[model samples]
Target: MEEAAAWLAALDAGSATREEFEAWRAVDSRRAVAFAQVADAFEQIERLRTVHDPLPEPRRLGPVRLNRRNLLRGGVVAGGIAIAGGFAMQAAAREHAETGVGERRTVVLEDGTRVSLNTDTRISWRIKGETRSLWLDQGEIALNVRALAGPPLRLSANGMRFDLEPGAFNARREPETVALLVLKGTASAENRAVRVGALAQAIGRDISVHPAEAVAIDRARSWQNGQLVFEGESLDFVVAEFNRYLDDKLVVADPRLSRIRLGGRFTNTDPTELLKALDASFGIRAKRGESGAIMLSAS
Candidate 1:
């Protein structure tokens, strides 16, 4: 699944070649199935966006255009039959749960495991025989894994595997790393065990486990309540975090504004309170740009 996501990202970024993708996909039949599932999920997201947001007017900058042919190099369409066959084989067993921007949801699985999904998250799972497998495609989730007479609950995110004992844990998939916070019991990755109050960050094949600070755990816990807590974080960092739940992103227009440090607890779904606080406390002004983003600058 991670390899499929990487291929999709590379294709979206115009960094993948048809030859390379085909070679990778040909290695195993399951690879085609995983790629198809990821592609289908991406298409679903695009469809949802189209339904919620109207199409913008087309802009012409120059004659150069990156069409599908230029981007995909005829790979996706050529492999459609194999992908479709693969999808049909696994469609019945796999179940998916997802949330939109600024949305949260909690679900109970068949095995009595409870999962709380954060904003803009996607996850899929399947219970086959004794193994209960879950894949976090993106975003964050908190799991209260139920103890059953089995091997263990298996979870995969960002190419890392975690065998979690029946317990609670929060997992977030970041751009470069997968953060796992063990709240109860233990989680094993790469033959190492992470206990409660411990945080594990996985980058590629390497997993680093360390004790989590009190503030860090508190910040993680706050998100489930639709709140964000910061402690002396820079303006740029705060803005970036807020943009996760915002459609019209907040931008620091002035260079000096990015360096301002502040700490507060604010609602993650809306930036109005935070904006007002910034105005009253720091003499900062917020204005909407032509692109619809909120721009911040010194008053």
Candidate 2:
């Protein structure tokens, strides 16, 4: 599990090359199993965080590192929340909201800030005098700040705080990564600021900011339309995404099939349709086991 987490973190940090991933996966079948287990565990964290959104007391002055493995074991089942992945932020929150699996909800806070909680998302927020602050515990949220004469809206995620300049933007927090996509106005990730049509990804301790053009912006916000857009994503990555909205998880049984690249758009509501599409296009076969898990293999 540690190795799996290391590989995932390396990939998230953009430090792992394709050859490294391939070589690591080629060593043993158990490595693949470990990777799958770790992936599924994080997916569960994505959903379970909504159900168990607990805020721990503020740590001492130094930076607090949230261990993903410990978070998976302790927080998910025991309702203990850890920020995980060595990101530091203010811990206490004034209010919290969450959405269950396969659910999306729009919430209007006291300050009239409309927050759209995507599937299995949780957030902690506070509206103080002249300052609106929030923390993204897990999943994604689209914040449409009201144009009232109030404080600037601020959000904390993955150990960094963002001051959102009035407008609309989306932020997503995963186990080891945080992404900020500006849709309308401006928002600052750490010290780096982004205006309209910008995408910033914070992985580990590094941040990558890119201009979000029309196509990328549309794809990023496609979840609002009940669709998921992918371009040249791996089979494993695609399956991991499809597992988010699925009750029965999808597993790629053949390790050799993990790296096959796929592209296109698909409905996020139905996993079976995606499986069928994969079968038709990539000649992959899906089988159901008695344990209620769906396994995909080369036909």
Candidate 3:
């Protein structure tokens, strides 16, 4: 097991060659099994770290003595293969759903849970007997969870887990944080409860919850209606939000234009109307850049 851990660490660090790994694993059949177990344990530890601790102190592993009894005990030869195969089956059972840029889609899970995906979003879910898990890889989604017997819906995003009651919620994943807005019912993460009109923003293990403002809640609802409702938001903020749904992104070329406040409802798909409004109201020019980005600058 110690050797397996050392090999795994070396592989992870990109210091181990493929030829060297194959030669080492060929020495003993049990060595391969031990290495698989060590790799699995490492993966499980990483997942736990993401959920419980963002930055944990490193700890060195002590010496581990291996024996024939230890190798054979748990039917390691047969059980190791079974465990590896089981993981493959579990992955296959998950149904993946995604949306491209400027696209929106709604999906109904096997358990009747409705999920409305925003642009450029990726998610996978498995709804089977005694298993209800959804993984949000990126982007945003609004979920209307169905009431089902047994355990509540388990949502995993950015390695954080939230057990949600039958309710409506909007979740968005950014580069550094995951934001959850509870529209109805409740959700619990790390033993903290989040009720309706509450917003929970998680940065690793640190999660903070507060009441969502009326505009924020309304914005969440408007996305499903193919619109973006901005109420006196900064030009920079509105541009960033609009870029999410656009392949040809909006860029603020002038720093002076970023702080300008604007408010209105606009279609999520096209930025033409918003650009015209900016030009008409604030003398902001929208020019098509070489890279096809819409550059916003003062006229």
**Model 2: per-residue lDDT, tens digit, 1-299?**
56776785555333465457769988999887766655555544444433344533221112234356645652233222322221112222256677666667777888888998777777867676676777787888888987767546877787556678778988989999998889988887656888888998888768888987665677667877777787888998888877776667888999999989987778876776777788899899999988888999999
lDDT of 1 by residue, 154-187 (tens): 8878767788999999999997789899989899
> Model 1 Cα displacement at 57 (Å)?
29
Model 3 regions more than 4 Å off: 1-86
lDDT winner, 2 or 3: 3
User: Which model is ahead, 2 or 3, in terms of TM-score?
Assistant: 3
Please provide TM-scores, in order, for all candidate models, with all chains considered together: 0.75, 0.68, 0.73
Count of steric clashes across candidates, in order: 0, 3, 0
TM-score order, best first, reads 1, 3, 2
Candidate 3 global TM-score: 0.73
Better of 1 and 2 by TM-score: 1
Off by over 4 Å in 1: 1-80
**Superposition error at 243 for model 3 (Å):** 0.5
The total of clashing pairs for model 3 equals: 0
